[model samples]
Target: MSEKVRLVILITAQPGRGEEQVAAFERLAPVVRGEEGCLQYDMHQVSGDPDRFVLIEEWGSKAALAAHDVTAHMVAADAASPGFRAGPATVLEISAESVA
Candidate 1:
């Protein structure tokens, strides 16, 4: 097998779009997990801050992570929030090859 890795996405709100962003991501998770190469898609909120949302993802490979960027759901996630804070989006990935 090629191996697998985890991808983490951190989404920060501009000001007050937290709830909307969370809801948007929530709707996105179900569909994202169904996408090819996606092993796990989970959303998280900061313990103290409601405006910060995080995404935990697992993929089969780096190529899979790259492909996820342009996935229809991603595009929808971008467009889904016609009303997001749109502050910053951080994407980080750990490749299986690096671990071993």
Candidate 2:
């Protein structure tokens, strides 16, 4: 089996679109969670910065994460970007190592 993939996405809302951005993510959560290989898909809003949101996701593998990028829900989310985003989202892939 391949190693699990972890992704962290930071989304910043446009001047007055924080609520809309949150709503969009809420709508997308279930769809993403239902995809194959998805382990977790959680969203969080920054306590001090209402316009900042974070998405923490875990997938079974790199392939699974790649597959998710082409899904209809993702496409829809990309298409609706202008409605809520202040700019391009920041995405990061993470890996962990254990110490013995």
Candidate 3:
């Protein structure tokens, strides 16, 4: 069986553009959640920093995550990011494992 894949994506919006970035993601969450093998795809903003966001995601396997990367919504997001994002996102990927 393939192991689950989890990712923490850190997004920083351009100064004063946080609302635009959040709105864009809000429109995207529903579509992403409907994709196959999407176990979790939730976005959260930093406690005191409106311009900083975190996307927590979980997928059934590496293949599922790969498929997600090329989806239309993702592609559009990438194309539009430069308008509102500070720079490239910081993607932190992790694989499920037994620590005990």
Candidate 4:
């Protein structure tokens, strides 16, 4: 098996779209968590920023993460993203070894 991969995704919702974005992520969460190689897929809203959200995800490997990016749920999310996002999402990928 390959090394695990961790991802932190930051999303900023468009004006008046925060609730919609949260709902979309809530719907997508279970589906993502069920995917092969998904170790963790958790979402969080910023404490003071109603428009800001975060997704913390862990996958079995880089390949698994790549596969996830192409999944139907992710595809739909990407398709609907422009309507809800204020700007491009920020994504950071890391590994324990890299941080050590």
lDDT of each: 0.78, 0.89, 0.92, 0.89
Q: In order, how many clashes per candidate?
A: 0, 0, 0, 0
Instruction: Give the per-residue lDDT digits (tens) of candidate 3, residues 34-94.
Output: 9999999999999889999999999998899999999999999899999999999999986
lDDT of 4 by residue, 25-45 (tens): 889988999999999999899
TM-score of each model, in listed order: 0.78, 0.91, 0.92, 0.90
Question: Which candidate number maximizes lDDT?
Answer: 3
Tens digit per residue, CA lDDT, model 2, 5-82: 988999999987899988998899999999999999998998988889998999998889899999988998999987
lDDT of 3: 0.92
N/CA/C clash count, model 4: 0
Clashing pairs in 1: none
Among the numbered candidates, top TM-score falls to 3
Q: Which regions in candidate 3 have their CA more than 4 angstroms from the true location?
A: 98-100
Give candidate 4's error at residue 50 in angstroms: 0.7
RMSD of each: 2.8, 1.8, 1.5, 1.9
Q: What local lDDT does model 3 show for residue 72?
A: 90
